[model samples]
Target: MSRVADVKDEARSRLRWFAVHGVVRFFAERGIKIGDPQAKLIADPVTRANPGVVYQEIRDRGKIVKGRVAYLTVDHGLIFDLLRSDDYRTVVVGGNLPKPLRAIERRTRTAALHPLAPPSLLSVEPPSHTRYRKLVSSVFTARAVNAMRDNVQQVADTLLDELVAAGGGTVDIVSSYCAKLPVAVIGDILGVPEADRDKVLEFGELAAPSLDVGLTWSQFREVEQGLEGFDGWLATHIAGLRDNPGDDLMSQLIAASEDGVYLNDRELRATAGLVLAAGFETTVNLLGSGINLLMNNPDQLARLQDDPSLWGTAVDEMLRLESPVQMTARVAKGSVTLEGMDLEAGDLVVCVLAAGNRDPQVFDDADTFDVGRSNANKHLSFSGGRHYCLGAALARAESEVGLRTLFDRFPHLSSAGTGIKRDTRVLHGFRTLPVALGEPATVSA
Candidate 1:
């Protein structure tokens, strides 16, 4: 064929691929049938806000409604069943990597895996998942997180001081406070050097989208580059810790690997990467969302300010009301029945965690944010079953201390600027929250 003819053929092929993968795949992920007129509703922020409406519609249609590309479940009971059952599984990457990314991996032959790289906890099933979970589960237990309370508090205090210093008590809380606290706490937990904490924050945010399925080609490249940079740095640090073990979680995990806990070098890199990356991003979103919730809901904010003891429950309520992780997907492994819907092997099951948290059948005044709600812990913000968040305790501790400190330090805090919401489909939170730390200036005498 002539060169011009070959180029024209390649252009046609590119168009065909985008039509199939880009347009079709995006709609399928949202649980819309190809001919559905209601597809536009999914793109609307007002409609998206109450995922319960879509969830209930899907539930009403069937236990599982098969979209063009995947099956979806929003029924609270079905979601829990799917999460806990071995019948369903997770495919973290889902073939989203661009050709160039795959080519780069083949050429580089690096031992380092992206933090969201497959076979890690977020992607694999047991016995691999079981083995990986066992390696660090003990250290992430409630007891371990409790032991770090003073450190967490100290980090929150230090960040608050910085917040007060910046913008003269008028600050963007997401940057000046929420964004910093989690990384500092997780950094301290993983024994990251003080000098490197800022990089961890930078990399954590950049690499977080690796957890989602909707990456554009450009996004895939950025995610890959960020993961490579962070993972490369992490690999060197991990090697040093392996040789000179310390009291930090990284050293402990490395020591365990040496003592025959059975983690390969690649697994070691992915594990540490996952811990710092996942721990940092989710907790940051949690704190940011929690602050957004309280800022908008003055009554609940007042309740926490008055009692102080309600901070724990208040955090849970925030998680329930504005879950950091709005949705996650699973794949069915075999023929099975779910709430009257039958599924064959290879069916994708998208679980709407945020929707389930708002199911009226589960909680009283499910839509309302009640800090004193007794059942707030039942929220699946940390997920459920074998795939539950490994750092749940640490996330809770960080947010509790962070919130308690912020409110205590600035009881008169109020919104000073329009908050900016993050434009993301998977992780939900504000990108910026501007607040005044003290009472508004009174008239001069």
Candidate 2:
């Protein structure tokens, strides 16, 4: 029986907890009585680009109302009912997604990578329809990814080799050391013909920012221009597959003549771009975030070195604490009441992974980085539902191998240049991480 005025005051005090619609949705669906009404702000064109992180108000009965619920803030996990409930039902998360994401159906957005596009490919969904999951899943399958490790190692090694060859001095790790490995590796796996890897990587980097419909024409144009070559390249490659299929993903999609839900040429091309971009983009962030944790928290790094077993747990802790991909937006089915806020059809919900992973109720010290923390892998970084990161295992393997090798090799490793800096919070990757490689700390093969 909380009155609207009281509810508004409480909601405002707790504003830090919610970043966007997640705050409103979380409270409304839980039946919390708050005067805060569902709304969005449109002060500038760019506001629409960051739908999840951005907020605004709607007029209710000619009175200014509540739309600035905190979705990105850490506290949303503490008070929001749906977010705090143990039931853990998956809700449709919308907003903060690219305009292309709008093309995906609501039901399949978080849980499955449908024949069509799904919401921000980062949501944690439980894919019950394993067939659809299976169709395009092989690209990230173990066998396929294992084929790329030596290649990844080569990429990692080559970057290091060049740095080490340059008298083993300080180097800009982001560009020279960390950034290129995953980009190059995924580029190879996606069958991005040798000729276009660089351009493909450029697109991958360009597209990693939070999808914003409010993107500047320049930003939108950047992707359009970058993708022009990418789409054409995929068309040519798939054509070759039609003439002669091979063991690669392009061939698999092409070879599925029947009983298999094959992607149309458009889906094939879009997914091709998405797969490469997602695979490399997330892993690159993982590497940056993990290495940053180790460098900043010396004790953890010491523990990792002392007991190599801790490496795996430390990486899990890293992912939990600083999820590479922050939050993803999902759309609702028809109309839904979330925490007392009545959402209409086509309304969007944003789920902040960083905030959820840090929910006070979920983890003992959600803020702290504890490599030894158990159940750390349960964090929503890879998500739980259907659309879980298909390449999670591969990403795990890559992180373990990459970080372990880097730290183990360079026992005396220390970064040069300024400490790592990252403007793009979406990917959470280091712009420049300068580190000197230690004496080949190859833990094992």
Candidate 3:
């Protein structure tokens, strides 16, 4: 059997184990308890013989319940009736976002700090947290984002120009394009220095697999040191902006603070950091998964090429199917009831956005990719309620521009046989994807 088949076989077997065990009832069976936060997970199994599986552990009532976040190659969703169970309570959403965002929540819970990081950004107070989101929405208005079309086009065009000049023989599209373009655009918007762009992108990949499951103290310390470096870098950048104003978002935010109608220095830095992470990293996964999807389904690719506007709408569908932000965490401030489980305050919950995006009941043909479908936005890829992504428009704009330019230039583009599967540590994406440039076109570099 092929290697891909082996991976698929393993996944199928794991899923089968969950089928007989019952989705929500497998955590205790797996022997995971207070050593970690308490939550229930319905995950993708290694085989089809079983349908549900226990992959994540729960320790306390404060944690949230996000069953399983799936991959595009997987069945795409896992569901459980936690709400209908006798045990239901509010718990922390124990994904990477909460832990990271919790460290500093002034202005960044809405932004992605790392592409693979998930332990931060949990909201203890949904109402206030939702309101905080509204304030950001006011800034990332449709008008503000629509204004970025020229910006997106500039970044996309410049990068492709460089790509074409490098002689277009065989390029690692992710390294050459997908991974860098969004970061370039967002970093510039936030005024991040040119010298640091590559390193920042690398940091986003550090936690692709989620928090250290069995890290020694030293390993965890290394991770913290890495985060400290990132934070320190941002602090210096903000200080520079404070000293000399520019036309970038950082300067604009500084001016807003002077007007007494905006974020403070700390808040400004957090917001800027959020913008960098959101604008670049999540889209990395989107573009990677998207290209793979297209290559896997040429029919879909042809359909998209026949109508480029479909790229905009299709982007949403892609986000749903292969959600880049995979999971988000939320912590409960006080004790609450859910799924009949009596829970206490400070419980952790890891809401699997990717899994929810593929819920069978929520989508028609949930496992299949159908860009023509009208229900794409129903996906929790951007999540729902208060914490919707502030950069959703910007992310879409980056993709629309990038994909459109790509198809326009290299309609015959295709992947090389294999790639560097983006290290599966913090994020699930491609760090390298070699593709054929195929037959130069009349397109201008």
Candidate 4:
């Protein structure tokens, strides 16, 4: 923690980052020059924002298109199979690098508990994955989520009330409502104090890009700082919970044990941190994308207005049309044949979930966004199998109630400007969504 130690740690982190991603950037840039669609997908911001063309190109190439770095798949069925299969494992940072680079990574591994690191459900496979998942699964079960619905609605209503009180000018919905609502819910669930909710949001924003690949040194440093800060704060918070438990999920997790084996300090921190951050990040994207989609497609909005029951399906449709988490990768555990394509051990497969959601074979008129689309719920947006999003139910509940309440309150909301998109390939959503709240709907007397 001294200045000297800090400098050393920073140097080590930089070395590890370069070992893992610097070569990736170098090849990605070279591949981009050669017009490699996969490289462009990895390196280009424009391609990340509008990936359909590259997805189509990948699909056209084959079921599994080899890229400069890894193989790409946009096929819905193959993605589904790969996600569910035990033959594939989650890709851990520094895991697939060459021996020398991995040696550099091992020596320089930082002490920060990253959301994508082991002990976090995102990074581990079964046995460990099963254990970690089991401890938290009960809290997110359908019954538990349904019990939280009224609270979610109240939170949505409170946020909308604050938005209404901001006069009638343009405001960034991402900050005011979309981001705040889910963060508040997740914060309360994690026993995060109201005063520190903003700090949690700040940490989340800084660390969001940790899910991505090929980050520049500055980006990597920022992400590590965020992770380090969150780790320190979470340790103190967990100690407080241990001393005096509350009704929050984190408190429940603190006391909960499995077969007389309780979670250690590191495991506890990783689980609590992942839940708190992942709890709201994607939902924030889902809400932002939902609002944008509704504004752009008035017919879909009109349909929802006519039949409020369609709100549930409307959220699913939004997730399908504009998936919050764009892509996820899996490394083949061993020799495997997927859809007649051979994959050896450690072969990386980047599943384009957004593209798979738009696969024509899976959904008729896949590009179209229809709230009433009967098969909207079948999309790969939540992913599949064990690594599927733990907060999917809560996200759905929050998005359904949040979007419904927003539009119901401001029935004539309109865009103020083009707005800013979050600059990350893995997570897709608005960073700032400026919208004009036309007028408050008349409430029943």
Q: Which candidate gets the maximum TM-score versus the true structure?
A: 4
Candidate 1 to native Cα RMSD, angstroms: 5.6
TM-score attained by model 2:
0.70
| Tens digit of per-residue lDDT, candidate 1, span 338-373 | 767787777777777887788777888888989999
Per-model TM-score, in order, reads 0.85, 0.70, 0.72, 0.97
Residue 178 local lDDT, model 2: 67
Question: 316, model 4: CA deviation in Å?
Answer: 0.6
Clashes of each: 0, 34, 83, 0
True lDDT of residue 315, candidate 3 = 87
TM-score head-to-head 1 vs 2, winner? 1
Query: Model 1 Cα displacement at 160 (Å)?
Result: 1.5
User: Candidate 3 lDDT, tens digit per residue, 235-301?
Assistant: 7888898898787766766665322555555555556666676677778878887887887788888
User: Higher-TM-score candidate among 2 and 3?
Assistant: 3
TM-score of predicted structure 4? 0.97
Please report, as a residue range, the 10-residue window in candidate 4 with the lowest summed lDDT: 137-146
Top candidate by lDDT: 4
- Candidates in order have lDDT scores of 0.73, 0.57, 0.58, 0.88
lDDT of 3: 0.58
